[model samples]
Target: MEDILKHNFAAPNQLATIYYMKERVEDGRSYYTFEYGLRTPIYATTSFATLQVMADSLKILQI
Candidate 1:
């Protein structure tokens, strides 16, 4: 959505945004033991791809 792109996807600033999203989901967001919420896999996959791009950019800079 536009909100995510504007608020969380800015270059240089998106690194922290992506990191925090991953951390929050991993550490705080609870998953049901027997069930799960409606997860749009396409959204999850796209977000991950974006994060991967960010990480790869950082790695290239370190070389």
Candidate 2:
């Protein structure tokens, strides 16, 4: 998991995934692992104005 985060993350966009597995022993055991990543084209917006613009453009495109 850390391996994937170290190898795949860049600077911007982020991603994560988790998994759980069970194993049988004298008692049952469960383990969990996770990975995360960052890439490009990610945006940090303070308002919905840009989203509204995108929605309007998509509506125009549909016509």
Candidate 3:
């Protein structure tokens, strides 16, 4: 089985962040991995709470 979760958040100053997660099951075992990234025009800063919220909102689909 395999599952994926993805989300994106946009902040002020043309800053954007993408969050991704993947889950896989093999041999009766489950594994997971996560990735996140940020994009900006030049330089940008965001609060930790905002990033946490974005991370918290991710949900992997069941299949």
Candidate 4:
């Protein structure tokens, strides 16, 4: 839902995106990451509530 909403509102030919990656090492160490870009977010975490707000706001555009 979030992805579709973002793409609908994103700049032409520039869709919004979110990325996550994880890596583990032989020493049992691990890393996690989250990445996203497009609309401005009120918080760093970019929770679902924010996405819903964005979606609702885009509805005004009626695209």
Candidate 5:
């Protein structure tokens, strides 16, 4: 799996196929490499409210 450095409060789902999608305010959203050199956006969320907002926003895109 491609090492993904996410916020301390972030969380990832059980499936190895999913993970915390790394993003930024400057370059907008971006993709991170995971297992098998797969590049996919994070689809998980942590209990942290701040992080939750970012994760929730992803739903709008149906990602």
Candidate 6:
């Protein structure tokens, strides 16, 4: 799992963080990549915390 933080230019004065996770398959030759982002206004601590909690609780299932 990796976390990256960057500014989001889509909206003015907004900050964004991108999270990436890679899962390898049993074959050792294949893998899966997952990415998500948290976008919020600058200094939005409550919203950022809520998004962080939601992101932490994410589950990836292969079907």
Clash count list over all predictions: 0, 0, 0, 0, 1, 0
Output candidate 5 Cα RMSD.
11.4
Model 5 residue 47 distance off true place after TM-score fit, in angstroms: 24
lDDT of each: 0.27, 0.28, 0.39, 0.38, 0.30, 0.37
Model 4: lowest-lDDT 10 consecutive positions? 47-56
Total residue pair clashes for candidate 6 = 0
Worst 10 residues of 3 by lDDT: 47-56
Over 1-63, each residue of candidate 3 has an lDDT whose tens digit, in order, gives 111111333444443443555566656545454454445767654322111123236333222
Instruction: State residue 63's C-alpha deviation in candidate 4, in Å.
Output: 21
Selected candidate, larger lDDT, 1 vs 5: 5
Alpha-carbon lDDT of model 2: 0.28
At residue 16, candidate 5 shows an lDDT of: 28
Worst 10 residues of 2 by lDDT: 44-53
Residue 42 in model 1: shift from native, Å?
32
Error of 4 at 4 (Å): 3.0
Ranking by lDDT: 3, 4, 6, 5, 2, 1
Q: Candidate 6, 39: how far from true, in Å? A: 0.8
Report the lDDT tens digits of candidate 4 across residue range 15-57: 4556543333434433223344554443232322222123225
Candidate 2, residues 1-63, lDDT tens digits: the string is 344333433332434332332222333322232222233455422211110123224211110
Q: What local lDDT does model 1 show for residue 16? A: 22
Q: Best candidate per lDDT, number?
A: 3
Clash number for candidate 3:
0
Q: Which stretches of candidate 1 lie over 4 Å from their true place?
A: 11-63
The list of candidate 6 runs beyond 4 A from truth reads 4-27, 42-63
Clashing pairs in 2: none
TM-score of 2: 0.18
| TM-score, model 1 to reference | 0.18
On TM-score, the leading prediction is 3
Poorest stretch of ten by lDDT in candidate 6: 46-55
